[model samples]
Target: MTSRPLRVMECAAGTPGFGAQTGLMAEQNKNIETWRRRLTFRSWHRGTKELDLLFGPFADARLADYDAPALAQYEDLLMAPDPDVYGWIVGFEPPDPAYDTLVLRDVIAFQRTRHA
Candidate 1:
């Protein structure tokens, strides 16, 4: 079996300027490109399971802008546990102020496991 490294980014809406923020983050983080394929766009209106999985065990912030169906799909992706895939979701703060956006980024890296 192999282990993978993954990275995910979650962006909120109404943050003064969203596109710019994304661009800036992308520029600074070289790993962002590797995980772009696994990006998931979610809305606050959707379920929390997907968000929970991405955010890890300690994600308590509320989402204020998201679509229901989109979130469901995202949740499904997160629940998938494959040794070849490892990922995490970034979280936004001040949930109320942000609306019309919920970005979920995920990355997947693979490493072979050795047997004794």
Candidate 2:
């Protein structure tokens, strides 16, 4: 961990350049343990119990492996209304095109296995 590397990381983190995603890179660079703790809390406390179950285990299992984009997707999912997300997981509705990613697809599969 040299100053040069730290400086480079800082520069990259500062360069997201957007209205919504400005901190995306810096957030991804945060300590994994901290992120896991926060994400776990969020997953377990969703307004609906069904969503809590669906996302809690899923986040616990996958949080360590998630890249920035995957985390962003999860955050976006959290921001969405729970009923719509439930419908997506249960296949009554498709995930929004923007949220259709491997992370979400895996959760959908997990939901099927749990129900089936």
Candidate 3:
């Protein structure tokens, strides 16, 4: 499939508050799966956040199985048309070691352009 720029908007950041760890893990996993779906040219928006959680580990596991072309295809998707897919990509403050919590830092709005 033709590559396009994706615009990722991180709506929120990971905090040390309640369910923060779980939430960060979920987000990380979900983001990974979202990457897989995007690379495979699947309609990610059609599914729910649960889909994101389910596909996260699956995508990570499949990474080692992907060939060079496939990996390149995935990277291409990240940089295409816009880096943000209606707020798919997110940013948070860095996790704090003292709190034993993951704090997403530098959560900002940005644009990434991918080439074929």
Candidate 4:
């Protein structure tokens, strides 16, 4: 049995392997920023004014603080129909099991605190 040495690559700027590693990192960051911007815009423009008001402010206040999983949850919530999502958030109706998430709870809490 032969043991091969593990190569630890330095990805810092101006270091070896920097260009490729940093380029990938930069691309990932750009994609995340693009998704965040798109979600924020969508939140502010949900067909009805009610939804716009409910989600727009939430997106603005919290989107930047969300990690990858949280961001994915938000993106899933946005994919739902506005009326359904709004109903769930406002407690007018129950969310489907899949739509029920911490992200939705956070939104509900946000709206409650924001309007209270």
Candidate 5:
């Protein structure tokens, strides 16, 4: 006998399996929100107050708009040593080529706008 094609059902709200999908989506959103909050806290609490001032406002104004790749880039920026990152932002030193990214440029631009 010939094999039959498999059919998949799309689950919309109020339909069977929809609640489970909704619950999973809600859980994923909650986890992302928590991660964002933690990043915001880190941005605001970097050891130096100057770094805090630099990152805190950028995180506050832009963090929520980041999708997964942007979030990953921001997280990577956060993981870099503070002095180096600050130096890059203020043009005292060039950012390591590997770490030079749109996210960093955005932060530098944000800082410029804030102080301009």
Candidate 6:
């Protein structure tokens, strides 16, 4: 299946949309599934336990629904140093504002919010 840019309806982040966006995403299930598989592998095997824990679970819970812009943001995040990502996740350091995006914020929230 070919990927087109994700055309999410303009809803407030995390708010439920008017059904149009959800319907559109339902149509892209194949592409989203493909991305989810690749991201799951990468997230789980990031070469560092801290990062693996932080990202793997978040990816498991969220990757399947990520739109194109969110995926692009996540790809940008994957390029950061693991140590920096770990520091941000653990609260030892804040993420560099340049790389601190909404996607990253959502990941951090997921990490902190999920219970074992």
The sequence of per-residue lDDT tens digits that candidate 5 reaches over residues 1-116 is 89775532342645666545466677888888888999999999989999999999999999998876888889999999988998999999999988899999999999999899
Error of 2 at 28 (Å): 6.9
Residue-wise C-alpha lDDT for candidate 4, range 1-116, written one tens digit per residue: 99776543432546666546456668888888888999999999978899899999999999998877899999899889877897899999999899899999999999999989
**Residue 70 deviation, candidate 6, in Å?**
0.1
User: How does each model score on TM-score?
Assistant: 0.24, 0.68, 0.24, 0.79, 0.80, 0.70
Tens digit of per-residue lDDT, candidate 2, span 92-115: 988888777777798898777777
| Candidate 3 to native Cα RMSD, angstroms | 20.4
Candidate lDDT (C-alpha), each: 0.34, 0.77, 0.38, 0.87, 0.87, 0.81
Candidate 6 regions exceeding 4 Å error are: 1-29
User: Candidate 1 lDDT, tens digit per residue, 1-116?
Assistant: 89665433333544556445476566745443323323333222225555335343222232222234544444554444422113232222222222222333321110111111
Task: Write candidate 3's Cα lDDT for 60-93 as tens digits.
Answer: 4455455445555445433433323223333223
* Model 6 C-alpha lDDT per residue in residues 30-100, reported as the tens digit of each score: 67678778878899998988788888889889977788788878978887899888888777898999889
User: How far is each candidate from the true structure, as Cα RMSD in Å?
Assistant: 18.8, 9.5, 20.4, 4.2, 4.7, 9.2
Angstrom error of the Cα, residue 104, model 6: value is 0.7
Flag the better candidate by TM-score, 1 or 6: 6
Candidate 2: worst-modelled 10 consecutive residues by lDDT: 17-26
Note the residue pairs that clash in candidate 6: none
Worst 10 contiguous positions by lDDT, candidate 5: 5-14
Q: What is the lDDT of candidate 1?
A: 0.34
Clashes of each: 6, 0, 26, 0, 0, 0
Model 3 CA deviation exceeding 4 Å by range: 1-21, 42-116
